[model samples]
Target chain A: MNEQEHIDKLMLELRRGTITIGVLSQLSSPQYGYSLVTLLDEKGIHVEPGTLYPLLRRLEKQGLLDSSWDTNEARPRKYYVLSETGKSVYEQLCVEWQSIVSSLNDLILNKGDDVNGDG
Target chain B: MEMVNRYVYAVTQRLPQSQREDIAIELRGLIEDMLEERVGDGGNNTDKMVEEVLMELGSPRTMAHKYRGSKSYLIGPELYESFILVLKIVLISVGITLVGAFAIKTVINPVEILDHFIEFIVSTVTAIPQALGWVTLGFALGEYYGGFKAGDLKLDKNWMPSMLPPIPHPKKTIKRSEPIIAIVFYVILMGMFGFSSNYFGIFRFSDGEFVGVIPFLNEAKFPEYMPFLLLLLALFIVKECLKLISGKWTMKLVVCTTVVNLVALMVVYFMITSQSFWNPHFMEGLMNAGIVEQGTEGYEIMETIWKNVTGATVIIFIVALLWDIVDGMIKVRKK
Candidate 1:
């Protein structure tokens, strides 16, 4: 694979587990699969339907999401929501994310300081 | 080929009534979009475009998996392993039980016993692999694609209006022959088992050697357990008759019954044959000299017959059930 494709693959791996977590966080309101993909993309978290749909199903199967078909429109759209379990997991995930960010910040700054001292 | 499309429909035909149309519409849209994209700029013929897209998409299996998500690897590295595991456990247990029941008959004519079980095992083993492959494939696809979001798996308790037309002029009649059919099967099994010992002597024995006889009664010398056989056969036939009449019993029930019948028949055969000293007790009795054992030859023969018959029966029943379900829906549409 080219460097960009390799990077994309790596990025996909990183986002794979978290995309469902992110989607669940936003699914207090009902959202269909395709529309949900667009919403995640607009929010700077790009998730393709191939990845997103499966994750949504996994999360739903795990009792983290709820879905229903709304045929009110010309086309029926399956809408998903955060279940009670999903809400709890999403909250915990947010806390873990914050801690990871803070730790990374400390590590990066320490690396910068070490370089300066060496120079 | 158009025929291939019909085959695809036949498989997808079992999709739940409510979801079928939406799934079909989505599938059609995807196929159309792919075709349109292929035809764009490059003036590829429609046929070529379809062939190319379908080829890229791969088999119905691959397409089905794609929609369902990651099914080939979902079960395990080898998809057949879990089902093989299931078949191994089930068939082995049944085989052991069958052997124990038929031990007496097998001892008399060990060859026959070996032949019978070998045939059964070969057929059972072959069948289970295919069944497991398809069933696991479907389940994996459903699990992957249906994406059972929380609460969706629950039986929809909420009364939704039927999309299809309501039953017009409900028929309040039952098939009268259903009861008669059950009675006839019960009588036949009773009559067969009732004189089994005498019957084996006269028919199953040949040239002072035990030949091929029924499976479940392999161990037992018949006339001994005629009453038990009668009772069991009655229950079996009654259960089937009830299900046939009710129509409430789904295809799954029929499949279960068929499996049970095969297992029961194997047990019955072993019980019947074991009662004799010589494997071909009747023939040996006629000679009134030595124990002429037919050995495992009979078993091999039995096994072949069982495997072929069971395998064919399982496939036919599954296909018929699926076709009938789809046909039933189509009929409803017409009405």
Candidate 2:
């Protein structure tokens, strides 16, 4: 593939991995799909409604999210919040993410030093 | 708006019947929310806003696919590799067999060489779509009833590295296509036997028509043995299908294979030894046609040769069946 396409694919995978953690972190409070999209976007993590809605449904299906429809407004909204199981899973995921980030940071920082040392 | 309704309809139409109402309601709510948000931001031109919102949401088909959580693939990615492998094996083997059979026919009767090539081409072309249709149908059925849901594509919370299957030794691991190909081969053979027994007989082109010269097997006797033959074929097909689905050699499969083969061998033995199995008038017809001179040493030699060939064929089939049973036992033991 071309360089631009290669980078685009890599970025897509990177975004996909982070999007789940981002969604779970925010779903501690109840948020409808559109509101969740807006919240993530405001925080500089732009997720499309298309992606967010399905993910919410999937999370709910997996018992990671609890969802209920509120018909009190002019338009009904299905709001999702983190389940009891989800809270534990999200905390574990955060710990794992932190370890990965630290490991990667160390590896990346050492790259130039290793090359320079060899020279 | 009409545009909103149209888009919702488009999305819901693609979803399963059970899911349609709930998804449609959710989609309508989402769209309305999007439009409301846009209008609140002082967006003029309601039509333009609707179009923009829809565009941002992406194609209705893709949105529907996301909501449904899976694309409606007749044979999905989980089964795709096996399907393609099975298709290749079946098509290639069928093509080879057809071509090889025709090539032999051409060699025996050089005058009909052109006809043989034409026959080969026609059969191969027709067989491809037939094979593809059957294989696709098999996989589709497997997908439908086998609980191959969209959720299967995801890594669930319970997933662990330990869940991965141990890498099998090459000899122990059964290729998924092996049983599928065998099933297709047997199905085609069954179809031929059921519908075109005349094709198995000797033919001569006369008066611009291919006429049966000397029938090898008595057509009338076929009805008597057909039910037994069909039962054996069904047993074989079921065994192959079990193999395909399991994708491995197991004790149960080995036992089933052995039983089926044994039953099939008995049926074959009975048919071959039966009084009405061969056409009684075949030799008389050949002699009358002057193909074989009557009361000659050559006739006696031809009869002896034919008897020996039939005996050898029966022996070969028995040996092959025995070999398969032994091989299955060995594989099961290895496992």
Candidate 3:
């Protein structure tokens, strides 16, 4: 009900859709579940292991990601990478995302301009 | 290590069988990786560190919910509002029917009225849970089979502007009171005619003392008309339910109501014409009470009027039904 809690909810909604794009962008190379978490964390996306692992499995089910077990490691790990279909899909998504970002920036900037009495 | 395995088991058990094994293995590996990052690869990872890693991941159920993103429900959000609306209408009508039935029974034999009141309360208590259970079961099936969203069946089709229903004017909206009052009215009629038609008669009194009653309906014929009357009641209640659910004058609803009313009209015609429907002794009772002479014009006129009374009411009812059907069709067709 307070302003901060309200803002946090809106921010969560904004991140929910774009998180898939972020995950897809990083799966060009095979990355294990833990490795992907650390990678995204280092890049400041901050996804949980619980959240990322399920997302990886769902994307694989949709044929947008491929997975294999790397049992050769000390601890058996499942590594996920982009599939043939995934690559094209991610490319198209990136194009759409760029257009969305530009349009949203324009809408926000124009509102600011109108408030400031400048075009 | 023990805590980590328990956590992994908790999350994987909720997933599908095939998924359980894979998710269990992946969750364990992820836990180990987190533990290693906290304590150096070979630096003794204490219980505290393992607990911290598990805590960061959240409860097992929250983790499972995230992994299984699909939502589940007995009555989902889409149909929940309509389900509750129907439940309220059904419960109130059933309660009224019980109350009316008990009241009529008390009047018939003139037994202890308090006992009838108690029985009415008890029946309403039992009827409510049965109503709730049936409505919940119905809505659950509606949700489970995914029939509620027919649009999902044609997911590949492009939506056109013309496919949208036109917004109804305020007057075109089916007021909640309309169908609710209609349902209550029909149930009261059913309770009266179905159970205690013979009891509907004239009561004589002298010196403010209790006196016997003269019945109007042929008691023997009441059972014969039960099925036909029940059919009419069912059709009318169901039509009102549909109207209540739709909440507006859509073409589909208008057509459906029209069809149901026409069927009820047929049943109403047969009801008034049956020879045994009205009591043949009604005129004799009136005359024996010294209200009229045996062959007076008043007696003959009263007899004639009583014979055609049910028919007149039936005619009026048919006309009302016809008017409702026509009015619905016209409202729906309006721009």
| DockQ of predictions, in order shown | 0.08, 0.65, 0.78
lDDT string for model 3 (B62-134, tens) is 8988888776457877778889887887777777788778866676545567888888888778877998999
Q: What is candidate 1's TM-score against the reference?
A: 0.36
Off by over 4 Å in 2: A114-119, B70-72, B76-78, B97-126, B147-196, B199-212, B223-258, B292-335
- Preferred candidate (lDDT higher): 1 or 2: 2
- Supply candidate 1's per-residue lDDT for B254: 49
Q: Model 2 scores what on Cα lDDT?
A: 0.80
lDDT of 2 by residue, B1-335 (tens): 89989998998898779878877788888888888888888866489888988998899889988877755667777778878867776677566667666865675567788888898788778877887888889889988776654556565556899998776556655676777677667765765577566566667665555555577878889778777777787788777767776666677878888888888888899888877887877777777766689789888887886667568878998999899788877877774
Against the reference, the lDDT scores of all candidates come to 0.56, 0.80, 0.83
lDDT of 1 at B73: 51
Give per-residue lDDT, candidate 2, residue B145: 76
Q: lDDT of model 1 at residue B213?
A: 48
DockQ of predicted model 2 = 0.65
Candidate 3 residue-wise lDDT at B320:
95
lDDT of 1: 0.56
| Docking class for candidate 1 | incorrect
Per residue, candidate 1 scores C-alpha lDDT tens digits across B161-234 of 77443434233222445444555545444544553343343334557576644333234444455666676776
Task: Write the candidate numbers in order of decreasing DockQ.
Answer: 3, 2, 1
> What's the interface RMS deviation of candidate 3?
0.8
Residue range with the least summed lDDT across 10 consecutive positions in model 3 chain B: B204-213
